[model samples]
Target: MWLLNGQSTWVNGYFYPGENIWAQCDLDCHDVDLVLYDRNGRWVAEDTLLDDLPIVQAPYEGSFAVQVIMAGCRHPRGCAVVVDSDYGF
Candidate 1:
């Protein structure tokens, strides 16, 4: 659960209007922040759970970006990210 300073991961995806989207980090990750951004590069939703897992919902439609950031870690590591939408599910 250690990550280097300023270490983060980002993924880009799209979402339709009124779509229900969720993003979560790996269970093993410690102190990770999940952020969501709209197509205009504006912040949409964020998850900052103390358990190091974040689940965010989309605020609007269009393209979106999901980012996983290490709040404060000392080691470099990776974590699994899950993004789901109600469109196909």
Candidate 2:
């Protein structure tokens, strides 16, 4: 969590198309951002606001990877976050 300014960690899963998926971390990981990529490593959707909650809509049915990046970490111990993700139509 407390690494380079652009450190990224990814979590992968299979999701159906035409649904909204979202991910969020703890308060301490507020500066972190979420990026959604398809199985082919194609960008689909992303939520990069001041808020920690990120949401994306899947354009196709396939396995996707959610990239969590530490845009900025103020905590001395870094930004260790527990991400909970789910999909819904």
Candidate 3:
């Protein structure tokens, strides 16, 4: 089993208006959960059982942070994660 964790360094809520933003996470898990939130401590989005090129798109044009947790009947030995951001359309 493996674990890979990463996130956007930009501060949420500091993003300019009308900014297009997106985040992509790569992971392999028997069972995994992904979550996103604003700097103000608001739940933005979440997903469960993410595997094989899982990606999440921001609903609004703003800054936010992402959190991912992996767990299941059998623990993951190893994994890899990468995060990137882009401007809003």
Candidate 4:
């Protein structure tokens, strides 16, 4: 996992045949949604988990192409994201 500004995220380790991920903003608060775009640029996830945070998680058997937004009506003040990996380096 990696962080910028005050948010954290991670990229997919192994992608499926056709999978993608992304992070979007809901400055209007009209909808609560988080989606992972596929390799074809298609939003994949079905819910919004990063509405209050900038962290995105892949599917049960997938990874993610996370994002961090800097400007918005409801942005993060301070945050933390945790990713587990045993590839000790």
Instruction: Give the best candidate by lDDT.
Output: 2
Q: In model 2, where is the ten-residue run with the lowest total lDDT?
A: 80-89
* Residue pairs whose backbone atoms clash in candidate 4: 19-39, 20-37, 20-38, 21-37, 33-48, 34-47, 34-48
C-alpha RMSD for every candidate: 3.9, 3.2, 5.8, 8.2
Q: What is each predicted model's overall lDDT from 0 to 1?
A: 0.64, 0.68, 0.46, 0.37
Kindly give the number of clashing pairs for every candidate.
0, 0, 9, 7
- Per residue, candidate 3 scores C-alpha lDDT tens digits across 1-89 of 23533221322433344333333333343444556677676886666543533345567656677655543323234444444345432
- All candidates: TM-score: 0.63, 0.73, 0.50, 0.32
lDDT of 2 at 66: 82
Off by over 4 Å in 4: 1-10, 15-34, 49-64, 67-77, 83-89
Off by over 4 Å in 3: 1-28, 72-77, 85-89
What candidate 2 gets wrong by more than 4 Å, as runs, is: 1-5, 87-89
Off by over 4 Å in 1: 1-6, 17-28, 72-89
Model 3 scores a C-alpha lDDT of 0.46
The CA lDDT at 17 in model 2 is 71
